[model samples]
Target: MKPGFWIAPEGAEEPVNIFPIGEEALDASHKGLTASGALAKLASLDSEALARSCPRAVELLSTIAAAIGAQTAGAPTQLFRLEGLNDLERRLIDDVLGEGEVAGVVALPDGTLAQIQESVLAGIWRVRLEADERHDYVEIGAVPEIVSRAAADLTASDIAIGPVPEGTMNALPVLAEIRERALSWRPGQRSQTINFTLLPMSPADMGFLQQTLGNGPIQLMSRGYGTCRVLATGIRHVWSVQFFNAMDTIILDTLEVGGVPVVALAAAEDFEDSAERLTQIIEAYFT
Candidate 1:
C-alpha cells in the first residue's frame, strides 16, 4: 500500500537468478512450469478427463479465481482446504497451480515445517505443513499466514543483552538500535531498516552481530528484477533482507525491523492479472 513496495528495488534490472552460476547450481535451479511449459508438461494427459474426475479440484480453482478478484492482499488469507482429496484430485490441483516466483519455509514450534510457495498466479499460495502428518491447503493472499505469524512469534520483545566478547567493537550501538525499534514496532507500523552494506562493519563486529541475531527458520526469496532474500533472524521482528545482482553478488544487505519485507509479498495490483490468467486456464481446460 505504500510508495516503495511494488516498484523494482534499487539494483540492476536483470532478471533474478536464485542459484549460483556453476554446474551444481544449474542442476539445482531447474525451472518450474511456464504457460507453455505447463502445456508441454500436460500434453499427454487428458485435461477434460482429469477435470471431469476431480470436481472438487475444479471448485477449488473457481474459488481462487473469485477470491483473487477481491484484491485484498495483506489481509486475512482465504484458505481452501485440500484434505480428503483422492490421488487423482490431488494431481489436478498440483498440475494447475504451478510454481510462481516466491518460495519459503517456516519451522513451527511444534517442530512441524510449513512449506510456502506462491502459485503461478500471484496472490495465491500453496502451504503444506509436513512432519508426522501432511496437510495441504491453498491460501489466497499476498503472503501466507505462516510467514506473518512466524514473524509475530519472534522472541524480540527483550533480547538477551549478553556481555561483549573479545574483539567486539561498534556492534553495541547497532544492537541497541535494533532492540529499541523491535520493542516499539507494531504490526501496522512503518518498517525500519539499517543498511549494513552502507554502514561500516569490521570482521569482528559483523561476526558479533550475526551470532547475536542468528538466522531464523522462515526464509523467503522473491525472484523479480533481481533476487531479494528475506530471512527472519533470532531477534524478534528483525529480518535480514539481502538483495543480489544477476551475478549473485550481494548488492545490498540490511537488517529490517518490523514486519516481513514487502518485496516478498505480492502487491494488491497483481491480483487482477493473476485472476485473469487462472480464469483463462480454468475455462480452457478445467471447464
Candidate 2:
C-alpha cells in the first residue's frame, strides 16, 4: 500500500494484491502437484507398453542413458546404431522416445541423405544416414552435429565483380561493400549479416549482384517452428539466408558472410543440458 493510503484490516487485502507488483512468488508447489497427478495418469496409460518392452529394448535404453551421461560430462556425442534392432524393438524405442518439433533433412555432396529428428525428450535425436545402404542411429545432443559439419567444408572463393549495368545506381556500391566485407572476414570473428531485402535496390541491381556472386552447391534446410534455408553463394563464406512462413512464403531474406548462421548451430551448453535431461528420462522409465 502507498504510505498515505488507509491501512486495511487484518486479512482484508486480496492475497494476490498483498504482494507488491513483480514480487509474487512462483508458487510452484501447486503446479507441481498438478503435474505429478497428470504424469501418474500418463504412466497408467503406458504401463502395458512399459511392462511389455523386450530385454533388448531395456538394454538399449540403458545404453542411451549412459551415453547421455557421458555427453553431459563434456564428451562427444555417442551414436547408438539401430541397424540390428528388430521391428518390435524399434516399436518399443518409438514408444519411449516420441517425436519432437525440431528436425532437419540435409543432402550431402556424395548424394547421401541424412535426417536428424529430435525426440519429445529434449536433446535425444534420431539420426538416419541413407546412401546405397541404410543406417539408423540415436544421438543425444542439443542438435545433430552433421548439420554444422556439412557447411564447414565449403570454402569461400573469389568473385569477379562485373560492370554495373545502366539504370542501377547503387548496385556498384552494394557490390563493393559485399566484396570488402568478404575479403576482410576471418575465422571466429563476429558475424556480419547484410540484408539486401531492406535495401532500396532495383530489379536490375539484384540481377547484377546475383549473377556476379553466382551460386554454390551447399544448401541447408532446417525446420522447427517455421523454416530456414542457407545456401552458399559463389563468393565463399557469403550465403543467402532465407526464412519462410508455414505457407512457404518468404518472410526474411538476407546475406550472411560468416562461418555459419548462428541459428543453424546449436550451443554446447544446450547439448550438455539435453544430455542431463535425457539421462534423467531413461532412469525415470526404469524406476
Candidate 3:
C-alpha cells in the first residue's frame, strides 16, 4: 500500500483513519494552493470558515487584513509580504485585486496578492508600481550619415547609430553630415525609406548616441553594436555606398541599392587617419 493510503480491517481498528493529514501535512497541501486560482477560491470564503479550514490560508487572509488596517491608519502598503510568489500569481492579484477601487487587497513586491479586510468590505484600490517606472531613463541619438544613407538605400527600417556619449559635440557632426546627404539626395528619391548605423569610435560617442536616441527601441546587434530604422516621414536624400571591409559588408549591402558613393578607409593606427578616411568616403558619396 502507498504510505498515505491504508485499508481498514473488519472492526479491528477505528476504521483506520488513512492519511490523517496533520497541521504539517495541511501546511504542505496549502503550498499548492498558494497559486492565484487556489488563492482566489480561498478569498471567496468568509473569515471564520477560512481560518477554521486552512490555517495557512488564514495566515494569508490575516496578512491582508492587517495591511488594510495599517493603510487605514495612513501607513504605506507593505510590498514585502509576498516574497515567494510566482509571476503569474502576482499578475493575477494585480489584475483582480488591484482593479477598480479595492483597498482591502494589496500586491507585494514579488507579485502576490494579500487581502487586508478586518471586516469584509469592497471598493478598494491596490497600489501597483509600474514596470517601466522602476528603471532610469537613458536617451539615444540619431544614426551616423554613412549608416543612415546606407540604410535608406536598402529600404531597411532597422539600423544602428553609435556609441556617442552624453554632453559631447560628436553627434552634431554625424547628424549634420546625414542632413547634408539628405539635402543632396535626388528629388526623385526624396520620399525614400532610410535606416541608420552608428559606429561609436569612442565611449563618449556611445553615451552621446544614448542621450540622443532617448528610450527608443534601438536593436542591439551585439555588444557595442546597434541598429535603428527610419520612418517614411518625408525623406530628403537617397543614395547608396559600399565598404571594402568584409566587416562592413552589411552596411554596404544596406546602402548599395541607390547610386551612392563607395567610401574606402586606409588602414592606419591614428584615429585622425581613420576619421579622415571616413570623411573622404562621405565626400565621395556626395560629390
Please give the lDDT score at residue 159 for candidate 3. 26
In TM-score terms, candidate 1 sits at 0.84
| C-alpha root-mean-square deviation, each candidate | 7.1, 16.3, 29.5
Question: Which ranges in model 1 have alpha carbons more than 4 Å from their true place?
Answer: 1-31, 42-44, 132-134
| Predicted structure 2: lDDT | 0.60
Residue 127 of model 1: what lDDT? Answer: 85
Task: Say which candidate scores most in lDDT.
Answer: 1
Error of 1 at 286 (Å): 2.8
Task: Score each candidate by Cα lDDT.
Answer: 0.74, 0.60, 0.29
User: Considering lDDT, which of the candidate structures 1 and 3 is the better prediction for this target?
Assistant: 1
Candidates 2 and 3: which is better by lDDT?
2
TM-score of each: 0.84, 0.65, 0.19
Q: Tens-digit lDDT track for model 2 on 96-194?
A: 666554544545677666756666555677777655224677877645667556555556556687677886756788777788888888867877888
lDDT of 1 by residue, 154-250 (tens): 7656677677778766788988999899889887888999987767666667667776776576867777678777878887788888887887667
